[model samples]
Target chain A: MKKALAMLLLVLVGTLLFMGIYAMEGFRPYGEVDLAQRVSQAYIDKDVTGENPEVVYGISKDLETGSANLVTSIIVNYRSFDTLGEVTVLFLSALGVSILFGSFKGRLRSRYQPNFILRTGSKVVFPLILIMGVYIFIHGHLSPGGGFPGGSMIASAILLMYLADEAFRIRIEGFKMTEGIAGSLYVLLGLVGLTLAGYFLSNFLNTGTVGALFSAGIIPVVYVLVGLKVGSELTGIITDFLKGEVE
Target chain B: MINPVLLIAIPLLLAFVSILYKGYRNNLLVFGALVNAGLVLTLGKGEYLIGGFKPPFGINLVLDDYAFLGLLVINGLFLLITLMSLDKIGENATVLLVALAGLNGLLLTGDLFNLFVFLEITAITAYILSASSRQYQHSFNYLVLGTLGSGLYLFGLILLYAVFGSLNMADLSLKMATADTSQLVIPSLLIFIGLGVEVKILPFNGWVRGVYGNSDSLVGPLFSAVYAGAMLLVFGRIFAQVIPLGAYLKTLLLLLGALTLIAGELAALSKTRIREILLYSSIGQSGLIVTLFLSGLVFPAVMQLFNNILSKAVLFTVAGQMADTTGTDDAEALQGAFARHKLAGVAFTIAGLSLIGMPLFYGFVSKINLLFGVFSLDNYWLPGVILLGTVIEGTYLIRLLVKLWMPGEEGLVSHESHATKAPLEIQRARVMGIVVLSAVLLVGGLMPGMIQNNLSESGRLLDETTPVYLFDLKGGQ
Candidate 1:
């Protein structure tokens, strides 16, 4: 009976979905020109001319936030509130994994470690990987890579070291400090913006000449903090996953 | 003008900072909850812009009556539930605070994408907390379902953004009102499917029973009351207001809601376990609330949600205590429950009665309002369907009450008590929490006028604020 009911509901839903699709009008595919007629057009306009003189006339993403990369501007500046939420999502996942794996008191190190060559190579490449991650986040406003990607990169490097040396203990204390400080700094900066510019997470600081490494007001600074936070959080999650729970 | 952003910010900050103070984590959670409750109660209404940018550009945080009510419910309940779960939720305290932050963001965000982000945060945190119990498979199932729901929800947002070229709720609403609504059909359906999963509407709620049953009972109220309440209101805001519901869509919601109501009631009627019973009833109540909202009975929808929060808070907390004392959560274990614990038994009876929509209870008013809404819509059959569901709901709930008041079995010991035991102080604290919840329910039942007036005003605000334009910010700082 349950299966029959399920099938019946499925058929109804499928029919309704089909009717809905058939009824919809003027829904264009991605990159259609009609999109240029709506609000995103203003964004595109601002992206091209650096000013939208029609709607919020004379206010442009370039002039207001000064991030050359549009996605970075959107993620870090235009909708930083969502970015904060995304950070919380990562933080919660990490906390959850840690709690799940935190039951065992003793460390459950890997039974087999990598060979000498792999260990030696990981040790040599770890700092270099860290530098690259830092660079990616720092240049986030001007380039493609930003906090999330950069953080994942750094965490993967750390994971490599863990595999290379089973006894290489994670200084959870340092990671905790880094994650806390970085996450709190993002909120603090937003609050600071509230005080300075009367808007939460506003571009309170000066947006230097565009295309510069240090430009885009607080975007780079926030992204850097986000990078450090995500890096530490991902490292913590990976660490917990490596230590499987006892049966 | 308090920045409503601070509500989300402060909790998130404390959640991260509490990690540093591992020894005093509970203290940090308590402090955070207290501050949030206070701020939410005192914060004035206004549009608070984020990133110093205007709407349709930078995200705006709304502080209207709808958002205000959600804030109060979430933060207020968090403080109470925090007190209840203090000893039980150890390292999971941070997750709770973060989840509260996500909920606050969900209530306050004026941007569609921001809503999606906060929804993901809440879903992820819930998944982690739910999976922390012995039944990992259930939580895993919940996580997979929730993630799929969120994926579809995000896809819907993309479609909306594609058609309207905006992500702000108000902007999208304004555009959708003027645009060809036929163009919105697919997107709206996608969103309904997505929100259906989150809000536990019928067949989409394959996850409800296991997660509620297996998780720590102390946190059960948080799921059934706080999380479910906020999500239902958001569902109303987005569907009943943001998108102009076409006739076909309205019929879809109404039928689905009535079907869900019957399905939930039947499931609950067949169940003899405590958590499963509450879980199914909760789903049934959500269906009723959704039906109310879809029928344009704003007052009853809000009233039902408020009443559900109170009753569930009372029932779940008391039920958790009953389960803890008796060892098993089965209905048979409830025999002589009143003899063992008088306060919990009475609390359960009053709350159970309210759930049955008895006279002098707030549920009675909500049920009347729901009936009026169904009739006023000129839908004659819906009332019959609703009444039938209520009858089934009442039969099982009354049966449970009888079980609770029954005499003890001589020489029969509860077999499960030996497995888990909590200290006396924790038990006392939990019962105290139950007392507070039941007190509110009593006060609400006796003076239904006050809460009804307030909820009606909120309902009026909800009705008036269709196409909520929250971007008219005044001078700040």
Candidate 2:
């Protein structure tokens, strides 16, 4: 009865949200809204600080924000502090897992024995998976995939190994060190910006050209750090959970 | 020239580094806390932009009067709580460091989305802190509710962003002032429910009882003073200064606050357990402060917030100590727990008295100002509700204090012979910390002038300092 009532309430809420959103001028059926009238346009145009010409594919030089990916420009450049915070959220979650499961001695053994190909296949796949993860985070400024997804991909590789071979255990201490170093470097990079310039997390490097791999000066660097931190933290969480008492 | 971001950054840096040096994490936590508290003193009034971008475009940390004062009190209390309970911190030191960063971020951020990010960071750290008791059930409940609360807040914030196309607090306020505020009602209500969970409003605070009731001395004071104070200040910032509210929404929220206040006090009145009483009292105090904020009485609301948090810090510490020592916080079981520790006892008594708004204590100053603020707004009925809540609150607190201080049977005179045998062992550091907090209360009550000068002089925006700061920003004098 309670579940039914809650479900009904949810449906009512969904209906109201639809009505309310459509009623507002800003949310006027999404497609009818002018992109030029939006704040995101300024972000894409790279004109928050000073005026800029239209961004080009591989030609825009010394733009305010240098990321070709508009989302990356917003997440990494315009509002990097919030990204830092988002990373801390994941870090805290991983820390919570370790704290709760720190005392456990070893990994939980799988109930079924792994097949011959499965164990061998995971070992083969792990390196390839790690390279893919690196690629995703490295190209985060020019592509849709960023640190969060790339890091999750790395953790998924770890998870695969754990599933395939019951005795597979990576040293969590290494992951902890990686997470710590990566996180500190991210902040230190921001502080460097603060020291040289007057702002924090400032892109103090040369923006050669848009659509280039070397472009978006600090965005890629921060993304790489985030990828490392998130990867290690997620891996730590996975190891901690595997160490939990199996039912 | 010290950026306010360092207050947040230093702690986070320490927290990240602490993960590598597990043995020396406690030292890092202490160093970070001291640095943060020291840095807060140097912060003046201005907006510090991040990522080298301007406001409403990039994130900024606003060091307005509200944020500056909030940072001072929070970092001060956090430092004291951390130093006093170093033994209780154990493995939770790094978690505590991250929590400090999160709290500072919560107070300092001017971007709504950035605030949500800090909110999540703070809430997640709090979830870890809550799990320290090993009562996984309550912690789980808190996790679920807190996550849901933040989600609702994000939902509301997304709606606002959709309408305004901006996330900066000052920018949003300017836009909201000119917009049709009737469009704000649903999103406003959603935001309230999100904040209500953290603020311990009625029906939304089911997890407070178990978590707070089971808290140790370190977690107790930190949660009560530091976390509660930060959340209320942020609440005031968002609702009072930013979100332009219409008539119906204001009334609805104000009523919710009043109901929460009355209900919290009534429930607290019936509790026999010392920790439960203190926790419920905290809930009631939160409600009153929220009501003050909703009424647009910023000064009195801030006064009450600090007063409540400071008093609750002392009160919860003592109660938690009792529960920690004797394994039970039953007021009857732990009768005369303070008989051995006279200093802690006096501090607890003073904090309780102040909380109940007794004369010559800071709570009295806060309460009087609160009533005066309400009355000046031509709010007649609220005073009646507030006074009635105070009377009930006093009755329970005094009864608890009397039982803790003097423990004779009902038929006989209160005597030392009837003191609790439960071996209450409050450390020297803890005692000194509570004494210092309670002394501030006593001194604040006597000299409210110092606080007033800070407020009237430094708190207001666009004062002499802001013009200079803006001139510096625009690269001119």
Candidate 3:
């Protein structure tokens, strides 16, 4: 009985305290007289000119970046560093798994390999998936698909090979080299930005015609690099995991 | 066009690839770390709109100072810790990397719902890591508490979305600042209780010790270094942006911190196991940092608080290393170890002194700053309790040290002869890293100006035109 009363009292006290805070907040002034009014007003006023019109114009016209997708322009060109970090995360994960699970070299335990129809079907789908991934990467600036989705599609192609052929094995060395080169190229591009533009990832090169396939100063180049890095790194990780456990 | 969406996409892409690496895992791990670090370092100062939409309508990823600083700490330490865990964790490496990606996503994301998704990813991976060792009882305890915490946090988000009709942090902040306070009262309380699980405040920190005690030593350090650190950053961001009830929140935080510190110290003094002692110590230290932050001591104090965290991480890592070498983490078993492995012993001593806030170490500088800040605020009782707790903390640490070094009959058995020497090259590398880190801590302690400058810059980044003075009352009040 004592314990139950103590618990009830604690709940009551907590409720009262919460209510008091809420009441105090209710009694405070609202709307035009609020403390955060200035910041909110500044935000609201921004829409009058469609959100920092001058800054937008400066990016589009003065910067000569013809990409209609301003967000893509900023990510690929202005803040490619973040994208690079994202890529590195995947690469490191693949490396860690391979190091831990790479030693196993056992023969196949399967009683039977895949039948002819399944193998043939996988082979037929492989080229289509690869082509689709390339299309996604090339048209990233104009469409919904970008480096990540495209890269995953490419990994799926590799997955097809693993399923179709019992003797199938990915070229680990080639994949690693491709991953390294892609990463290096991404960094080199940033360094180039430092020289050509004012900042490390600034896009100051020529902005091609807007809405065109070849438009966006560095968006296409960045997407291509990211796609390559992602594709290789994903393939590597999948290969490592699917290789089975080592004793 | 470079969209912030790419940040999320790039890692997801790499995670897919990680599934394919049949061998050569070390190369992949190193490659990932380098790539992530490069990206964070090179991420230029700018805001990226999501899907070419403006803020208040479309989402925005602000790559401002807060995000930048968080990126540096999370990515930098993440790489180092990953490298450190290479030999220890082995095959579970890919799972850890996936967790890292989830953590990074949690930090960089602007959408509240997305944050929840990322949080789940991190939590799920952590659960797997914790439960990997089947014999560990603490892992089960951690799962129970962690699950409860996640459920509460998710419930809070649901309530918040129902009230505000938006899931973006910036939008929530703006709406919350002006909405009917009565309507928000329940949601605010719910969110507080939910995040409290991660913050490990009083009543909520019940599971932390069990979790840390049961996990692999390497896993514990990473949890402290990355998981807890990221959560704290997230808390700070939310506090700065969303919460308008600053004074009340600060008071509650300060009181909880004081209580947690007292409880943690008393618990640590009673613990016989080495891992338990470290776990309690971390809890107490975390509480201490949070206390300083909530005291509203302004810029200098916040900087001091950050410095304390950095030093504490180093100390915890060193302690872990000492345990690895000695074979037994038990204070009774580790007695007389100082005479044998002199280098590790010296490292342990320095780290312990730093923890105790000795005058020459980085811990001392931060502690003094914290005490001074508290004193200036005329919070006499709070500082008194902290000082008393500090004494208790010193007593146990000193006792452990004495047992390790002092020679006596039937002293702690010498395990030095039986211990296998770590590779000479690995030892050299570890020692070098420790020396560099300790030197930096020492330099920062001696010349407080260097740290103060960085703190000022950080403060300016937090809010320009706001002087980063501890005693400043103009805007804080």
Candidate 4:
């Protein structure tokens, strides 16, 4: 009864506080209506009322990086730093798991023996998954998919192999080297901006013709680097997790 | 427009690679710290525009003296703490790096929403770090309180965003300066009160003692040093930029700080355990620092203040470690520690004196400056409260020291000393680190003028009146 009364009192206090704040500030819900209007305006402004009639209207002109996709431009250019940080977060999580769980010989657990049908099916689908991952990364600038999604798909390819063959394991050193090289390449690209354009990560080199595969100067390159880095890091994490308890 | 984005990016990159190559965790940490330090040093002062976009239109990272000092103190302490814990905190090294990255990002970003993102990362890492050990129930309490704190912060951010269309700090500052005063007041209160959880201000800091006491001793240094230091800087930045509401916010902070000081000191005095005492001491110190900052006592003299905070954090961490090693954090059980470990005892005494604001100690100088700053503003009561709180602080710390060092009857040794004997080399290294830090603290205290001059040079780079220091990118006027 005491606990219930305390909880009731707490709820009452919270309600009062909320009501007081709402009364003071004229509380409105998450501004969903405003966001929707802005997004719609963005679409309409780009398509119908835009200056470039041939290239598609109303959408923001600033987002014409070889990719017709605005989300891609936002992810790869406008908010690339956020994406980089996010990828690094995943990598760090993977590393933490590995450190917590990995062993010297990488033999903390025995390989799982799979049935023939499942192994055969994995063998058949592995190449397809790898192809899909590559396709997604390559066309990221023109589509919804980008580094993180594509990278996970690539990891899925590797996961297929682990399932298909009991003894199969990707070389850990190779993954490390790939991750290192990819990360360095990304930073090197950013540094290039510093040297050539007088700013870090500045995409000043080429505007390349919009809606083309090779446009957005450094966007594609950055995406590729991000893809490789994310792929290798995720694979490393999964490998560590699979490796079992640290001795 | 190389924004302070690199500060976050560099550590993130290193953290990612550290995981892939576990053998080089220490090297990666060092490299990350050095790179961040060098970047802050060379980036010069003034805001860095992002994406070639001008602010109010595009978000920009401000690299003023306040931020520069904060970055230096946080990153510098982070590097030291990582090095100190390399052997002890094995396997958890990468998480520490990520935590550092999140902290630096929190300090460097100018976007409010981005701040939330970084805050989440930092809070999550802290939760993991705090909960790494399952032996203590305090970790669970910490998790619950910490989650509540972050949730409150998020709610506050959402409210702030609703009031103003933009989330960029610079834009928000301008909006706040002209917005409806009544409408704006409540949001500001929410924002400060919400973030106050991490700041450990009064009413919102109930979890601090439990959290700090239960976490690993090494983690305590980072919390008090980098985590708290960076959050304080962010709080300062928010207040400094968002004018019109500055006075109200300042008043709120003053009251909170005073309350925190009294509460913390009182709690510390009551606590018998070493961890509890240190935890409460940290809370009290935080309150004092916030009081100084809000009272505008540190402004225009912020460089000196920053130096004080940095040294004090180091001193507190080292003292906590000493407490850990002696096996008992209990004042009664710590009898004879001074004789048993003379060097550590000496270090602890100096740190204690500094905490109590004794003459010739760094804390004393900083406290005097704070007192003068507050007195000039004609708020005499705040300083008196601070002085009284300092006395309370002195009493407990001294009592602990006397009990540890003074001759007494045989008592039960602390469980920590017997659980697993620390390697002699590790102990020696810790002692050495403490010695070095304590010496620096002493030097900073004894010769404030010299350090003040150097900081003034850096301060001039950002803004003259700011008083905190940075490298003048445009040229030192």
**CA lDDT of each candidate?**
0.79, 0.87, 0.62, 0.66
By summed lDDT, the worst window of 10 consecutive residues in model 4 chain B runs over B468-477
Over 4 Å off, model 2: A1-18, A245-247, B410-412, B463-477
Segments in model 1 whose C-alpha atoms lie over 4 Å from true places = A1-24, A45-62, A104-113, A245-247, B408-426, B454-477
Model 3: CA > 4 A from native: A1-82, A106-113, A245-247, B1-243, B246-259, B298-318, B341-347, B358-365, B375-388, B407-477
What C-alpha lDDT, on a 0 to 100 scale, does residue B379 get in candidate 4? 71
Tens digit of lDDT per residue, candidate 4, span B428-454? 666665666667667868997876677
TM-score of the A chain in model 4: 0.75
DockQ of 1: 0.58
TM-score of the second chain, cand. 4: 0.87
DockQ leaderboard ranking: 2, 1, 4, 3
TM-score, cand. 4: 0.80
Per-residue error at B161 for model 4, in Å? 3.4
Residue-level lDDT of model 2, residues B405-427, one tens digit each, is: 78887557988887788877898
Between 2 and 3, whose TM-score is larger?
Answer: 2
Worst 10 residues of 2 chain B by lDDT: B468-477
Tens-digit per-residue lDDT, A83-183, candidate 1: 88888888888888888788754445655768899889999999999999999999898889999999998998998888888668788779989998898
TM-score of each: 0.90, 0.96, 0.65, 0.80
C-alpha lDDT (0 to 100) for residue B364 of candidate 4 = 68
Ranking by TM-score: 2, 1, 4, 3
lDDT for each residue of candidate 1 in B1-477, tens digit (9 for 90 to 100): 788898888988888888888887788889989999999867877777897778878798877766787788778887898897677786687888788888999898988899999899988888877865657899889989999899889888888876677898888888888887678778887888899998999868999988887645556888888889888988877876687778887888889998999999899988888888998999998898888777766656776788888788878876665566556677664555565567866777878888778877777876776676677677777888889989999999997777666644434543433222322122767777777777777777788788756644543232244335321111000
State the weakest 10-residue window (summed lDDT) of model 3 chain B.
B465-474
What CAPRI class is candidate 3? Answer: incorrect
* Deviation from native of the Cα of residue B261 in model 3, angstroms: 2.9
